[model samples]
Target chain A: MTSSSLIKSFERVKEDNRAALLTYTVGGDPDKKTSLNIFKSIAESGADIIECGLGHGANIGDGGAIQDSTYRALSGGIKTDDIFEIIEDFKKDYETDVIIMTYQNKIMAYGEEDFIKKCISSKVSGIICVDWPWPLNLDFAKKCKENSIVFIQLLCPTTNEDRLKNILNDAHEVVYYISMLSTTGQKLKVSSDEIKKRFNLIKKISPDKKCIIGFGITADTINDFKDTDACVVGSALCREITRSINEELNPATNVGNMVSDLKQKLSS
Target chain B: MKLEKGIPLIDQHDENGYWGGKFGGNQIAESLNYPIEELTREFEKLRNDETFIAERDYYFKNFVGAPTPFIKLENLTKHLGGAQIYCKLVSKATGGAHKAYNAVVHSLICKRLGKTYIGGDTGAGYAGKMLSMAAAKFNLKCKIFMGTKDVERQSINVFSMRSYGAEVVPVNSGSQTLVDAVSECMRWWTSENEEAHMCVGSTVGPTIFVKICAWSTAQISREMRKQVMDEFGEVPKDMKLINCVGGGSSAAGFWNEWIDYDNIELIGVEAGGPEGSSKHAAPLTNESPIGVLHGATQYVIQDDQGEIEETESISAGLDYPGVSPLHCFLKETGRARYTSASDEEALEAFQLVSKNEGFVSPSLEPSHAFAEAIKIAPKLSKDTIIVVDSCGDSAKDSKIIAERLGYKI
Candidate 1:
């Protein structure tokens, strides 16, 4: 699918007075079969875009919840190649916009050209390399465009105008603006006004691309995206899945409820 | 060849006809080649520039304590019962090491290249301290990357660096040590070219870096001449200069001024690791061949297929697998003799110096140099004067030695 179509889908969701549910699941988190089922479940439960996290051994940015998930994935013997296999399986059974959020080493290890080709073959819609900067990585940006893969640039609260302009100049598809300084699971104390101001500044620089705010965003924080293109609730949904696992509840049901509640709150 | 005034070390061809021949080209990444080349050319133009020279001289004299005193190791020499030993007290330099000299020069070079941010990788933490001081004095942004292991080990140095306003980025890749820190810094420098310049921590690269370090070493040699004249009334006829070689900075610093002096025998002591093992010895004296690395062609430890081999030594400062190209050339031509001291011998010497002289010389770098002095002193007469470049103090390494030797501090 083209990047334009994916952007259209998000716009349609906004038009329908519903939040774009961007569900995040660790690729091969438990196993390939379990993760594929989770991806299928996410697609069926009205997730507009599925973000599959490729876990690494040294996860500098991951918090406790994701760190445990990564360890479980590794203990279940999930290698990076298993991620592509899981994506291929999900693509065979489901049709939805897919984005791979991962560290740069996995891509470097896979060899850039081969990785792009595999993403293209799997029909992956976009990619967000967490540690890679947009300005310093123009070569990867060029290759991503050549392979018809949308490259998503991340802007944070600390991003200055010069860096923001540089990011926007090379950014494609969408831009994911981190709402705060802390990691995925950490509590964010910054107010909605602050987030909105940061988002507006980024929007001014990247007017052509969709801007989604992520990190510590929950059902209560849904209104934070009143000025944003979309709100991404990742850690909240993942936390619910963790709670369900501890309570012996079905994770699929818990995830479904979490996203549905956040969606309702966003719409209200 | 006539030496020019304020020219630092005189650039003269040796009788053996080697002029940075095999050891001189810093074989860095092709991406860095242009910037380094540009910097080198620009530094050549500015080296003799009055403003640059004035700034250098001022910083050296005031900030770094130029012409650091040369102290004779009379007590230690008498105990050893052979050659009289002296030390070029570089610990007197600001930031307490020889690194200030190289760091100031590189900082100036970066400023001339229009770089506002300076970064480096350090094992001894000397470069980090020096860069921090330079950054504070010059109003440039400075960031230093260190191995996580070194961070845990050198907490004092880390705190010292932060005290001077340098951001220390701890790198936790591949053994989480100096080598990995250097690789990560290279990656960062490549990505952040617009704002950052890598002020390399070693003196093993281009002629300019060597020349700057040589100037620092020349200070040692110049002071030694004065000390000898003050003590004995003339320049000593027979003198042996011994220094440790990691990436070969301190050794090169002392050797640069005396390369043309045929009467002075230059000796370099490398970490032998274990006697028979490659794990403890650095690459140049153990398992290395002719190859280019980090912008210079020199003796490099590489695998059979020519990939760089990772090296380890008890001393973090001596953990690199490549030696200065000039040192490699000197080794090949036999202008300087290279010897290896085992981790055990270095440790013994470390303890001996602390116990006898009340001087705690840290790491295996200084101890290794002293170990070599001990070995060679027995062969020389009592009148022979040997100068050892005491690179760093042992305060940073006391805990490690205490733990390894099972002794309570």
Candidate 2:
């Protein structure tokens, strides 16, 4: 029930009156060591919050972009426990708030209570999973709150405003407003007016709740969602890392450049 | 249905909340953000609708031939010696096997859910044929994702699906078979179109889909159980029920009712591939450890690194890395027994039944189960009765099995 680290991270970003920049990196993408290095570089490059991906090879939650991203991580022999080593490594260099956006299977296999304990111990500020079946999982959401870990809510565009109001009431740390109904890497189909309308509604309902737009928020398109509190850069950055790994280049530095370069533009 | 240790949905998850119990967990009910209650409501409403049931009954009786003849395989029973073995002639159903039941039900549910585009993955081509036909019957656009290799091998099956005015998409991913096709189907659902509901052709998925699919197929068990009671005095003393399992949809339906039966026993057969080699789809046969993949927790066939290992079997439908989560629970709790028959044994059973019974082509999936039945039937008492499900027609598998066995059919 106390203030989560994710809130502090957002507060730190707001010190300059700017939205926090969040990046998602699936652990063991390509390899574990390089993934850790990429995390450190992205954290240093100016990400206020970093979201790590978790799934046991089969990703039924996110779009195929993340699915393909997980394929690389899993193909690299990444397991759930390996994520701990990578997180521990990243925590050494930066206080960037860490959140694990994972599939429910990973948490279920690791044991939900045990997973929350690990999240707290790993200094993970927030947790969101696709498999949590929403209201059916509200009890676990309470458990997460008791453990002082923020249970981030995802607001889809397809959801009506009434539902958004209800979801906003329980939301904490951040509201991940998916910009469109499409998956990650799809063309931005929502107009700025609609994005602004939805974001404004979330803000109007709970100005206290931080709202960040995700899904198809690329480097160029990120400008459209500038009015929101933050934009989650996942598939785009992961794609850069994938390109680096595929071409035998330094993935950590290349992805570092991708985020750092985007950071400068978002700094506006 | 109550059993000694397991229920279909509850026991499948072993205190860990995997509806498949330690074996299956990690299921997305419908879409990424779909509320569980809505999906549950749809299933409940559709399953109970009087008109839907009437329509379902009408379709099964007239089109797919439901209540398929539960007949004693007199020739095979006499040859096996000890017990009188019967076959639940599902192979005689439309789409040439037990696949018609689940496929038609899936089609109905998809149409009820107002899904415009119905998409899913299939390995054996039987399901694809059934689903596409259902889609065509219901006037819904259908697209099926099959493994590139399976589509090529089961060319006639692909043709059958397409002939129903459904599009056949070949997935050329890892292994280029069923598992890869499932992955592609999921990707297609999440990435391509969120509105298009996945018509998963298995009894192993999220709680709602698993429960509903099994519930739909339970009609088979209900019909057969009634026939068994009518034909025999009561349930037979040594009644053994055997069915082939890729993802265990038919077995789920078959065992759903018999779970509470006192004298009836359930046996699930896995594809053991060619003998003396580790290349098999036998998750339970090898006592596979608990793992999660493709959205459910089940006994997954995996290597040391935890990556899903490829499954190799004579039947493409049986060529899956995992079985239903319920089967895993049944095996782990000892409520049901699991055994695997090798490709050679299955082929022998296929030829044996085809030659004596003159039942057209039978798919390799049920052939594996019939092989196991053929194995134990002789060891039991003469008064004992055993039932093996002729799960699918072999018409789709004819060319492949013929080519593999060096027969020019």
Candidate 3:
């Protein structure tokens, strides 16, 4: 997809007054079918975007809950290819945008161009290679554009202007600005005003692109996007889904309930 | 003619030949196999590379003050009544220890990798000291993860590291010691910003680290060669090189350059702690079988289930239950001999050295090396030249020894 198309999607989501529900689930958790069910449930529950997590042997960004989910997924024979199959199934059934978030090794192992082509064929809208910075991954961004897949760039609080400028220049679909210094599933301790201020700075720098604040975001803080284009809630939703699966509850029903509650909270 | 760049030196043997048959080529976990293998290959090229050799030679000769004057202890030799006793005074090295050589190379590699921050695990107190020096010299942000218990014990070194602008992170994990500090440092490297690189403090893992550490250690042997020529008018025919094995860096360093020599006997003195053959010995010498930790497969003092076993040594430096992979390979190949020294013996030797040489070498490493020398000295003639690495100065440890032994310093 072109940069203009991504801008259009961002504008449409912003105009609908709907906080984009970005869901994250480890591919093939418990089993492929169960994980696929979780993905379908999220898409059906009004998730505007899905992040299919490609679990690495060493997950630097994950906390305990997501770690356990990934362990369960791996033990159930979930591999990288299994994630693509699930994404393909989700695409056949739903019209939501899917993004693959993984480490650079995974992409390099699968061959970056081949991985991007697989994502395009599976109807994935974007890709987030976590460990690859913009300056280091300019060639990767070019490949993504050639394959009609948006290359998402991650920005953290520690990122200075020089690095941010590099990221904004290469960013295609959305800018995922991390709200806090810590990892996902952590509490959102930073103030909404502070987050808004950072988002405003990012927005001013990349005026045409959608800038979203992620990492440690929850349903309670969905309204923190008053001055931002989008707020992506991932780990919180993944945590709740994991809690349901661990408690032996119906994951789809529990996920539906959780997303509905989040929708209501976001709207209010 | 201009020398191009890096060159490969060490012959590429089958994994079993170089790794003691414990670390087979295919044994590395699938995830880390490529990077580690690539690193090993790169290291082979760098090891013999003319520039690397020249840089190593220059650092040893100038920076470390190599040919660290060999001191013959007439009193100790006469007291023992056997072989000629000599000490390779590594205490004269910059940073007051032999670790400076390896730390410089590690820091240089991190800088080459574009890492602005360098983190290391400290137990021998050498990594922190040497890396602190490297950080200041190289203008890199340095973080040291030291065991809380070790921090309390080695306050002077900790203070020195801080003085160098290194952030000393005290780790209170399992056993609150070096192993725990290493694990915590690895975790920190994974979680922290990607711009930082974790410098393995020893020659235990990647062949590149081993090669660099070995090059640093070769200073001792190189100096010994010169000393032998100066004293005996030739290289001594019956010479033995001795150093203590703590995570096996010094031992590997010394042996790496001399392993190909047919006549020299390379002996690694390991900590026996309180238990000799039972629990407390370092991994390569005692409990560990063939298993991977960090990056290389070596003898690890691990449990039946392959979990890393906790170690206890009076000396914090020797408490790690693992040794360098090349040392493991040497142990298997019969090129280098391995021995153990009890805490009691090491302490006794420490006292002996202090009284005889008027120099107290701190940490059990030098004492352990001395203990081995003492044991082996009786079997050899007075003309035999033996080199034991006096790894560090004992000024700091003297206080602890006095307090523990009820003696005045």
- B-chain TM-score for every candidate: 0.89, 0.93, 0.87
Best candidate, DockQ:
2
Query: How far in Å is the alpha carbon of B189 misplaced in model 2?
Result: 3.1
**A6-40, model 1: which lDDT tens digit per residue?**
77777787688665768777787667776787778
| Candidate 2 lDDT over residue span A185-217, tens digit each | 676777867888888888888988898777777
Would candidate 2 be rated incorrect, acceptable, medium or high by CAPRI criteria? acceptable
Q: What would the per-residue lDDT of candidate 3 be over residues A1-268, giving only the tens digit for each residue?
A: 5334445666777898665667677777768887888888877777667788886533345655666677677657676778899989987878777778776546655766778878877777887766555554678888888877788877766577776787787777577887765556777767888887888888888887777677777777886663466666767666776888779998767776777676666656
Residue B222 in model 3: lDDT: 61
User: Tens-digit lDDT track for model 2 on B1-409?
Assistant: 2234345443344433354334554455223444334556787787678999988888878878878778888898888799888888778888787667777777777777777778878898877888899889888889999999999989998999999999999976568898888776766666545467676778666556566667767777878889888898587777889999888888888777788665778899999998887878999889775666676767878764456787788888888988887777677667788889999999999998888677634588899988998899999888888898887888888887889789898
Give stretches of model 1 more than 4 Å off.
Answer: A1-268, B1-20, B205-218, B274-277, B359-363
> Compared with the true structure, what per-residue lDDT tens digits does model 1 show for residues B1-409?
2323232332432322224443454333223434555665776687668998888788778877887777777777887888898877777677778888878877877788898899888886877878888888888899998999888877778888899899999976545776657656665664455567777787654445555555545555555566667877966788888888988877777766567677888888887876567665465566465654444455666543233555666777777767765577577666788887888888888877667666535456788888888777877898798888887777667777788799898
**By TM-score: ranked, best first:** 2, 3, 1
Per-candidate TM-score against the hidden true structure = 0.59, 0.88, 0.62
lDDT-wise, the better of 1 and 2 is 2
